[model samples]
Target: MSKLRLVHCLLFFTAICILLPPIAARGGHSDYIHPGDGNSSFHGIARHLFAQEEPRPSLELTRGYMTNDDLEKAMKDFTKRCSKISRLYSIGKSVNGFPLWVIEISDRPGEIEAEPAFKYIGNVHGDEPVGRELLLRLANWICDNYKKDPLAQMIVENVHLHILPSLNPDGFSVRKRNNANNVDLNRDFPDQFFPMNEDLALRQPETRAIMTWLRNTRFTASATLHGGALVANFPWDGTEDRRKYYYGCPDDETFRFLARIYSKSHRNMSLSQEFKEGITNGASWYPIYGGMQDWNYIHGGCFELTLEISDNKWPRAAELPTIWDYNRKSMLNLVASLVKTGVHGRIFSLDQGKPLPGLVVVQGINYTVKAHQAYVDYHRLLAPGQKYEVTASSPGYKPRTTSIYLGDNAVTADFILIPEASSRGKLLRSNCDCSCKNCGQPLLAQFFPETNNGITLTLVVVVVFLCFLLQRRVRYNLWKQKQSSRRSITV
Candidate 1:
């Protein structure tokens, strides 16, 4: 063959190799094998390489031990064994068409509200796969040991555990960080009115399914499992001037109560510490525009927690056992804590006489109030029924408290905030500053006629007309070029 032709052929082969899947394109590496291949040496080596670095020895051993198939099969096997205790269903499909399975484990079956439901979602991001495996293991362990383990029996009997083992299956399949459309599922929520990129907002099927499921189910408390920095991020991300993030809502007492429960259970975890010197503002963590936890709190009315499970990226299979050891108790503790405090309520608008769309209704204390009884602080921005609050409030409104009692099951409360006439009048008066002695002009002089509406309409018309004219010009140029080419061809 000619040297030039040979070079071209070689380049073509290289391009083909680059385009192929990694498992197929790479010629040399260990062959993909099943976890149960019975080769102890291989399993040991794999475990060692992916071992977790946490001080908890038990969890580090089992951290990176299972694959996607292992988890799926385990879920199926678990359902078969515990048919009486749990039922599995497809909540939604992932972007890659994988089923987003939700395994409902309960003591009795009927409307979920008949019993308390605790939601545990794992692997929202594909890179953090351990939660999926751990959840399966937990399910299996609970079923298998329920007869013997009193704690397991107590949990199964009292709480209905809803386990979403994989939230972003498309991301999990390729081991990518984000979903198939490269959107972070955690940040793709509709909590605010701002427009989202059409491609991204509706891009990931997994996220869509999750949102639908959450809308239908009324959960008391929920946790989303992720892997990266290990910390339990709480509500009301720090303020601009504050050194550390404070739970800003009136229900800060409740926020602290929940945080304290989580911290007490996972005392060894970094999130156990109180607001201190090194902590970052809760809201400013990564500056995410819309997040699942925030939406859950503001819109879903659930006390949601973002649980960062591990520090290792793609932890080794062997590390699975270790991860479970440390987290299993913590996860169980959250469920127990929710059962202990059945706190629940809805937020409403003070002026509109309807549910507020987006607000922070927290169960905390107002700094100005005497520190005696626990009272939830209300931020003016909370969405109705999206957060757990014993009390609710809005701007220019009197705060309302509910007598709803929290327990092992669900509780509901509606807030009716009374608008403050004085506050409303002050807001309506636009030129109250005109009363300043230095300003000689009357308040009415500072006010302009309502010409803004006409100007806005005119601007819209002009822009539309310009766009139409540009489209016509471009089409005419294309037509003229085509006509000229046809004449030349005839010549």
Candidate 2:
């Protein structure tokens, strides 16, 4: 509270900010335990633990294409036309104030279903506009074909597919790789290995919007569309040591399988000579920091892939239809893949027979997926033909594990957790808090003795730091006063 202390505190904060940039440049952002390490029942996300843009292909010839404004209108139109099957919503606005619109396609639009949810994000790189065009085509195609096409029907009935055609419309409008502020939207997420972009203010509006959207929604599986390459990229986006190498996450096998599904479904992606199988580990392709793909996997409990759908960043607008055709099956298959593979189930309370929105973990996999709060439904994707030990756990409830051989078709595993009433008593008597709560003391006081200790220690640290700041300020002021006195005497 002293003037001297305040000055010192101000200096300390300024120093912290000044020292952060270079380190952020090296790592850039924000546990991934996908695999490679040993042992199961949830491996560590990361072993070390610590962790294009196309040019003026031109807006002049953009007649047949949907402008950002057109895209918004088209989205609204689709929701209206497919009123029974679809609805429109916005995540947030872009830096240039473009509403980031999303069209949700499902049997029951805007309603919560125990069904698995999948999202397709496109046009992350503004100049690689192929994704945005293709995604709109995809949304329309499903709407028109869902009646007759079994694949389309399957997707509409089984999955809630949310399509965000353009994440960086400002970047797209300018025909650049980044958003309006020139920040690469794809590279603005918090990376796990290097904690760069961890500060919310430093991240761009588009990035913040995506983060906020993830916090509100639970996506079982999702994919973002990118152009300029013809391969599917999976995590770990960067290695632990920041080296360029083939690094894999805990569910490396599962991710590879997912990638393969897209590549093979595409007309010619599977024939790529650059990346065998048309799939490359993200780091193997290129090392990047603060990528959206890795962050989705790490924090959102969402299985995400970075799909490079086109080799040409900006092919002629005429190629849009062909590109959509090429990617149509892949897109539909990828969404349907959610219902066709992995483990699908719900959790419930044994006593009340009520749903519990608990978390599901595969024994060997490092990631955890949470069930929908309303439906208590969860969908987990793993490589088919693998045997996995799946475990479901909820707070204050007994955890349960089950083993199953997951085949090509989806397998259902429901859990009923028993409530554990004596956990609090066990916690107080545990080694972490050895002494029993004194009967003579207030119940609240005895129960939270460790919390009280923590507060006391925190106060002590704050006081000491304040004193140090005050001393430094006092010394600095004295030095200034001495210099003034010396000048006056000399005069």
**Model 1 spans with C-alpha error above 4 angstroms:** 1-65, 193-203, 237-250, 270-281, 343-491
Judging by lDDT against the true structure, name the best candidate.
Answer: 2
Least accurate 10 contiguous residues by lDDT in model 1: 24-33
lDDT of 2 by residue, 1-491 (tens): 69999999999999965653221111111112122322332122221121222246666656577889899999999988999899999999999899999999998888877788899999887777888999888999999999999899888877889999999899788777667766667667877876655667667888888889888888888999887678888998898876678999988999999999999999999998888998988787657777899999999888899888887877888888888889999999999988787887778654334568899998877878888888887788999887888899888788988887787677767686766755454211111111223222221222335887768745643554344335433633532332221111000
- The TM-score of candidate 2 is 0.75
Q: Please, what are the lDDT tens digits per residue for candidate 1 over residues 44-109?
A: 432222221223224444444455566667778778889988888888777777777778777663
RMSD of every candidate to native, in Å, equals 23.0, 22.7
lDDT of prediction 2 = 0.75
The lDDT values for all models are 0.53, 0.75
Alpha-carbon error at 455 in model 2, in Å? Answer: 53
Please list the residue runs of candidate 2 whose C-alpha ends up more than 4 Å from where it truly belongs after superposition. Answer: 1-55, 59-63, 421-491
Give each model a TM-score.
Answer: 0.56, 0.75
Please give the distance, in angstroms, between residue 380's alpha carbon in candidate 2 and its true position after superposition. 1.1
